[model samples]
Target: MQDGTTVRDVMHRAFLGVSESDTLGDAAELMLAEGADCLVVVRGGEPVGCLSPRDALGAILDGADPGETTVDEVMAPPAPTVPADSRIAAAEERLVAEGSSRLVVTRDGEAVGILTERDVLAAGTTHPSAGAEHAVRGSAADVGAAEEAAVDAESADAPTAEATQSICEVCGTLTAELSPSNGQMLCPDCQEV
Candidate 1:
């Protein structure tokens, strides 16, 4: 059942984004001033990561020296992105798989728009599964599949956040709890390189 609606058709044209080198405080300030919850981070003219209010709060709570911290330090990495022409259903699937709330819509590798779960619901896009459709129609599997899907969609629709694994040159760990630097995963000890 193709509705012939592209993500570009439904994406928000005006999105607030940031750069990787920006300070945490700066990113937060921008987000607040712009009335945005998330700030997209870019590098080499490409969508990279996103900084959310949650991320800023976590960094602050962790005693991160705001002046020394950069968006690259806290911005979520491996940002799940979608082509401008992507099908709404495909976008919905990625939103579930990546556990993100927004998706950066790109054209020729350049970000053009953003799609959020709320945006999807507001547009009345059908839920992904039969269970979801039933839930939306108020069927009591009491399962609330649609609600769950909404949650998943909201998170998935967002750009990718930091990954849990990285490649460590020192410990020879191909994928371990590590931080992101310019989209490459580096273990805590190997981050200096």
Candidate 2:
């Protein structure tokens, strides 16, 4: 990854937000339409929480009615966040420590964008020694097989392989681990859930 790179450099510029009063079903529909894996829950134009598809699924699994359950009742607390100017290394540390796949990007106490693992990987791939660490973990053939499996699982509906902007249909966040299965794009976490 680039030295001294900040959250702002890797965060997704476009993000989705929903009112706390919005129904779970509404949030899910918005996620599908926007191809987003998460939605910030806002009130008075300020973020209050976050809704992911997993949250909705959990509620539904517990018998909550999607159309009637409100975001406030199902959303997770606002995502672990980082200042836009914070270093990517710091953000990476936070993600690891918190066991989170993404973080809300903030500026001047306001929500801005989102930083994700995919962004970090993309940065790492551009560095001169990108393959050094992975090279130690496996043979070239092992790497090739992994890459082939990933390609075979990608959604045909995805606009391009280079488009990291696509959201995980199961989790509602844009991540590099998404794979299409049974017509739904699922992130690795969502796949297990």
Candidate 3:
């Protein structure tokens, strides 16, 4: 999902917005009407939190009246922000560190888009830079799998067994975690200029 793919490349440029003071019923209705999986909760025109479908569902199942509950009461805290220029891999790391499934993409501290787990998964399936993605992940098995898939899609020749089983030649930090680069196998860390 990475490999030079910036947050801007995969983030949703258009996201639905909801007011923090709005009734949960109203927010849920808006989500349904817009076919939105999540909504940006706002207060005074500023983003305050994120409202995912799970949040709404939990409130409903808890016997809370959506009409009486406010979005703030059910919404998760504000999502972590990543600059639009940030790498998807870094953003993915932040998502894990924050234990959040979504990230708010911003530029100059102003929200410009949103990135979700779904978007990352979609990119992984369609992105052509699979080898690079796996290299960054530091796993030979992953690199081999991604390479095999790429070769099959393009009908390229199969790589040597060593390519899939070797460690980084430049840095011994990883075992069986090298990717071909300029005819040499190197870990992503070593590939950095």
Candidate 4:
């Protein structure tokens, strides 16, 4: 890889897609079959939204029947995308700005791949500049002190827990607003009616 690598250099090319009309169950099955965490929701060959494992689980938590709920009803709005040739740093910047975990990589306006935070982390592990940039920004001690202060401030004003937090089995989204049913911990959206 070059010193100035682009998103295409590290993006996962085996991206998956699903029809917007498809059911949540269908989307989940597709993810399982493809071994993917998300699927692009398309309508007439154009991307309209993104159906992540979290969305699927959230729907189930909200008590929507997966088989009856359509993908369009639960999918997040179209994911932010970057051109295939965009620098990886640029993609990372976009991700940070949007507070997103991944970005859709496009080529000629067509979805071509996906770049996730994990991918960026892996890339950083092998690139010396990544660590240098962080060092230049702040010393490790400085960061630790800042984190400790933030935690201390938060704890000083912390409120008692009102509900238990749990991870959804189906989609892996952690939620505090949950319901327990039939020994299953579900988010409010996934709880059965």
Candidate 5:
């Protein structure tokens, strides 16, 4: 994609998809063969959830039989989605606002490619100031204000504790601040690696 490329332009077209009904063994096999850390969970050709390596590991550690356990039992809800035609800046904002490293891409109500923060970063690095040149779309530009409001809203509103705290995908370290590295959420220590 050029400097002004759309989300569709830079997204990962390879969607390693698995259904919720698939057995963990089958999912693991596909994941291993594909060298994937996660797979898109789909149903009836619609994006439904995500099957992450963490999910499968947790299930196995909890004594769930891989051959018998369904992907539904371990998959996570699908990440936030954005239209393929959306701006790269907006997609980046969504990734941060949603506190996720990845997002599902949609085109005309159909699940298409996957987008990651790294993709955005790569695009930004190509053109210095690209990050500044592009403003976050819509209300996403108000993340700072929203976060401030959420502080007061926490007691009277829904809990944002889970949203603030993140578990490092590599070492399972739980902390609030994390950055994506090599497709994994890394803590300060792991980031060095």
Candidate 6:
């Protein structure tokens, strides 16, 4: 498929989409349940935008009315998209050029799947890619761990005496920073790997 050079090559076909009318809370719930970084905001079967975890967190920190707010109100519009036949390398370039972490994968102008840095890494491809990328798509051996991590993320906000940190975004190492930014929990060396 086009020499497998674009983002479409490595994207996951099983997409987890959401509606623009859904609430931020619902989106968060879905993300935690699905281990998704972003959800497609579709209206009448047409994609309009995307809801990302960072956006939701920003809204939460701002004290926005998540219950009343719809995904449309917070989603980023005109999402960068690519055909399913594109090369993975091209997709990596697009992500860097756009300064975006998410890309929509379409077939015949309809949403079919989604591509993320994690997805690319999970594919087990040895091809070279962008400077900042991860292979998060896990194998069968990692499914249970992924599910457990999802559950942990879902229940992570609960009150507790101990302050456990978020897993490293790059290495999945559990730490004690609540949320580790820039992969600091693993130290600079591990993050560079």
Residue 132 of model 5, lDDT score: 25
Off-target runs (Cα >4 Å) in candidate 5 are: 1-3, 125-176, 179-193
* Model 6 residue 11 distance off true place after TM-score fit, in angstroms: 1.7
For TM-score, the strongest prediction is 5
Residue 71's lDDT in candidate 4: 93
Clashing pairs in 2: 37-172, 37-173, 38-172
Please provide, for model 6 over 1-193, each residue's C-alpha lDDT reduced to its tens digit, 9 standing for 90 to 100. 1344456556777777889889988898999999876788887656788887878888888887878887888887846887778777666556546645557887778888787645544553232222322223466446335535444554455434242322444554333333435644452434445
Candidate lDDT scores, in order, read 0.68, 0.71, 0.70, 0.69, 0.73, 0.63
Q: What is the per-residue lDDT of model 2 for residues 57-83, given as tens digits with 9 covering 90 to 100?
A: 899899999899999998989888889
- Give the Cα-based TM-score of candidate 3 against the true structure: 0.58
Please give, for residues 1-193, the per-residue lDDT of candidate 4 as tens digits. Answer: 3458788888998879889889999899989888887798877656679998888988999998989999989999988888989987787677656656678888877888888755664454222321222211133344345434444444455644232333444443434455677787665646754
Indicate the TM-score of model 4. Answer: 0.61
**Worst 10-residue lDDT window, candidate 1:** 134-143
Candidate 3 or 1, higher TM-score: 1
lDDT of 1 at 156: 65
For each candidate in turn, give its C-alpha RMSD to the true structure in angstroms. Answer: 12.6, 10.0, 12.9, 9.6, 10.1, 12.5
Clashes of 1: 16
What's model 1's overall lDDT? 0.68
Instruction: Judge candidate 4 against the unseen true structure and give its global Cα lDDT, from 0 to 1.
Output: 0.69
Worst 10-residue lDDT window, candidate 4: 128-137
Q: Which pairs clash in model 6? A: 5-87, 5-88, 6-86, 6-87, 6-88, 121-135, 122-135, 122-137
Kindly provide the TM-score of model 6 when superposed on the true structure, using C-alpha atoms.
Answer: 0.58
Q: Would you estimate the TM-scores of all the predictions?
A: 0.63, 0.64, 0.58, 0.61, 0.67, 0.58
- Looking at model 3, the pairs that clash are none
